[model samples]
Target: MTDIIDLRSSLANRVQRWLAGSLDQMSDEELLKLVEAQSPAETIAELLVATPTRRAADDDWTDLLLRGAEAKNQIARLAGGLLSSSQAAEVLRISVPGVKQRLERGKLLAVPLPGGQRGFPALQFQRDGHVRKGIAEVAKAGAHLDPWALLAILVDGGAEGGTLLERLDDEAVLRDVLSRLAGYGEHAAA
Candidate 1:
């Protein structure tokens, strides 16, 4: 993370550009708190209300927007990589509808993008433009989990020093990863 004062000063400078008034009038702590909880969308909300879109004290519309941004960020981080449907189709040498069908059938993991678009996890695919063998089997076995959770487990380089993707080709290795996935499901259910 960055130094708080510098971050606050930088953001205040950006927001100050939107209005002629100086944002420095705000105390250091107040300025930090205002910008800290907010994302870019929250800044947009602030700008909108700065003009004429004020609402009641309790009617904060920015909350959901902030949550949406956070969720998107988390998804991208957990998946480690993503590709648009078209990109995935091109990489897999399949049609767009085929990509969608694979996603629906749990043969592929998708990162949910904003505006209802979904992207495939790029790490799940090999350099040969094919999905790693046995990945779909583990994904299907872990269908009880969310995409982010499954991706996290798949991408984690365990004590073995490589991702589960590397060893998933072996029968025992695939079964071991599947057992770990089952453990995750049991834990999640509990």
Candidate 2:
């Protein structure tokens, strides 16, 4: 009886793993069909694991987590914490000119990508270690300087302070950023 129960348990686990979602090892079309057939929760679970590469699975999982985080973030944004250029400057702990310099140098993450992209989601500056620049901080820290400058300085890093900016310029960075952003969009629409 114990042997039979153990066999059943093993069988159930296999089925759950198989039914969880489409395997990444499959072709794109096959994977899409599997994903499309599954419910969102199932899809999320499958994406959490069951991929060929654990590394790839981790990468994908990070993406999904980011999406969920961004959703929570959207609610936060609606509650009114967005800062303007000068306001953001104060948040970053930098001069307004420095903020302007970063913007002019195309270092800042702009809401709308170049080429006049229409109605895209705003990039979450909060996630890039800019949470300290929130309204609460602005209230506490005094609003004279941009708080986001603090975040910018931190993200910029290194002796020169533009490495993060350069990394953001990479095509892969844009794709990953846009992908995570798009994931949030899907959840919002649902």
Candidate 3:
């Protein structure tokens, strides 16, 4: 454990030096643009060590942390059941472009995977190799929402009295639940 801790410390110091060198090489405008493009995880990690700015209150930092944790948890859950686009295409016996088209048309659901690629949940397909019924309708209804949010509704239980995954076979129940979720999304957007 001591050796592990020492190794981690050494790695962290190296990273800190690397980041410092990189930041020093960037123009102010470039630095701002790079910061703007950072993912929530990267932003959160930076904020943990960053000096509090005059524009941001302590409460604002806390809120950012909470939001970051939520995003992290969502991503972890997504990765747990995720299939790469290629894997999904293979499973569906469709071309990669076809898989992407399905996602774009809301015929299938997907979320942005960690490395800037999309990941489709395995639950979206049936054992018989068909897209699960009622999912497209749900996806269409929740089209305004983030794909990750739609995925959370489907996988996480107790929102509409139970998990949507188990109710996918029941068109009526699934649609009803999805409708309610879509309404929530719409309201939130409003």
Tens digit per residue, CA lDDT, model 3, 140-170: 8878777777777676665455467556778
Better of 1 and 2 by lDDT: 1
lDDT of 2 by residue, 1-190 (tens): 2223544655565546544433535567656655675588776565545454434324455456455445434432332333456665666667877766665553453232123321111223444535222223222222222323322322333344433323444455445433433354356568
Candidate 2, which segments miss by more than 4 Å at Cα?
1-81, 111-123, 126-175, 178-190
Per-model CA lDDT versus the true structure = 0.67, 0.42, 0.68
Alpha carbon lDDT at 80, candidate 2: 34
Minimum summed lDDT over a 10-residue window in model 1 is located at: 53-62
TM-score of 2: 0.23
Candidates by TM-score, descending order: 3, 1, 2
Count of steric clashes across candidates, in order? 0, 13, 0
Model 3, position 7, has a per-residue lDDT of 45
Q: How far off is residue 144 in model 1, in Å?
A: 1.0
**Count of clashing pairs, candidate 2:** 13
